[model samples]
Target: MATAEADVPTAALKVERGKKAPQFKGRDRWVFYAMVGIPTGLHVLLVWVPTVGSIFLSFTDWKGIRFSDITWVGLRNYNQIFTVFEKDFFQALINNTVLLVFLFLGPTLFGMFLAYSLDKSIKGTRLYQSVFYTPVVLSLAVVGFMWQSVIYSTENGLATQLFGGGEPVDWLGNQSFLISFGDTYGISKNFAAILIAIAWRHAGYIMVLYLAGLKSVDNSLKEAASIDGANEWQTFRLVTFPTLKPINVVVAVITVIEALRAFDIIFVLNTPRKTEVLSILTTNNLLGEGGGNVGRGSAYATILFLLCLGFVIWYVTNHYKSTEEGAES
Candidate 1:
């Protein structure tokens, strides 16, 4: 009788406690809704709205000024940009592409080299790093002016001293040089000038990025490589490069964007010889460099936007694929 009475009370207490507890299943529902709402609302307002507006403008002949007057021109803008007046469009594309090629090879590779060298103990490392990064802080307008004087000034330009065969040749003004730039330097003066300028600006940034990646590499793997009778080159090849693959991916994406969207430097490089690029070219066309063409400018911008999007998608997809493969292995 005593045991049965004790068991019955214990069961009753358990049931009462269960009933008194609060359910946590739906308690944080408000937090999820709030988070989703804010970002989605902002994206709709900022990105989607502007994108749709630009697309609409592309379909019409709208001078960016005075929205009161706008004409709708279907595919006329795009057709002219690609076919009728292709010189400006194609040339700008080529110049930007050339800059991009150099950017991918020069800064990325050289920066890796510099970072690897600095990975060893060296004197004046901080000073070197500071000096290298100084260019990145300067505005493109300032750099362009400084470099133009150095490259274009026949009497006082540095290129004149080294390359002009005793006198400075107007690097941009001389059509002969542009004609033969490929013959001599394997790239045009516009190509070389922009390549040098961008390298000076971004090389240090790449070095710093690589340095960070280098630091995260496991010290033990390196030591193991060394212990296994591996030389420094072998160790770096086997251990360091593999570790840096992810950093290279980031560097590539940044370099590609910088190359394509680099407007300020090329704009300031406006000489009589070659003052035109896609951004400047399109702007000049819109505002009438020779004659204003608002419809055409929008078309150029549209093309650039699509191209940038395409490359970004390509890089992202490849990056994810590589990551998945690595995970699988």
Candidate 2:
């Protein structure tokens, strides 16, 4: 009876403490509203308004000069994208896919391998890391320009001088194939050359991300695997790799985005023949450098946005569903 009576006061004290906690009143409530409302309003105005406007404009032919100029043509832009512009659209698609594959195979895997190698306390590990990471810190545009002038240039370039045999190779300008894959989608030798520079930078960036992921892994799991007579490769593949799933997802998304938006290096390289990606194609339309085609440009932009949005939505839905299932289990 006494214990039950004592528990009543403890419960009452907790309730009292809850009640005593500060609650926002009149003026404080206004401040809270202002804090949340202002940002929300700004985001709606700045981001959503433009996005909706762009989607509306995609169906219309507009010179982008005035609202009065927009004329709804109803699927004309999309029809051209499919029929008339099919070659350019398909070419950009194939090129972006090539970039995506190259980045995953070359940088993503290479970065993980590098991170695994450096996780061992090798001599001058920091120096090796710094060397690999330096390119990622440099501005891509500047790096692209440097690469163009120093390496790929036809006249007085390092590569030309080295392999010139007194006749400098036109590495960037040569449309002639070193090897053709088909009449259509074989690797362009010049495009492959540009990819070298891209991979160099991407490998370094991915290395840093993977290195951080590797650091967060528990040493005990590795030690346990070692005790089980597991070799280093077996241990990493079975035990460590699973733990790095989050980092893998992040790297995958980054690589995809990078591949899709590859521009600066290709751009600075004067968008050398057959090196076009979606971003460059989209920008060229928006700027009307290939003659004013606002409707077409907006269609491309909408396509890119929808593709990204779809991927994000799918990933988020799957991720959250799995999380909920795991929690329930």
Work out the TM-score per prediction. 0.76, 0.84
Clashes of 2: 0
The candidate 1 region of ten consecutive residues with least summed lDDT is 20-29
Q: Write the per-residue lDDT of candidate 2 for residues 113-227, one digit (tens) a residue.
A: 9999998878998999999999999777878788888987877888888887767777776655555557765556677778888888999899999899999999999999999
Q: Which regions of candidate 1 fall more than 4 Å away from where they truly are?
A: 1-48, 65-69, 176-187, 273-275, 288-292, 314-329
Model 1 lDDT, residue 287, Cα: 54
Taking all chains together, the TM-score of candidate 2 against the true structure is: 0.84
Per TM-score, the best of the predicted structures is 2
lDDT of 1 by residue, 5-66 (tens): 55665555665464543212242345656677899999999987876676677788876677
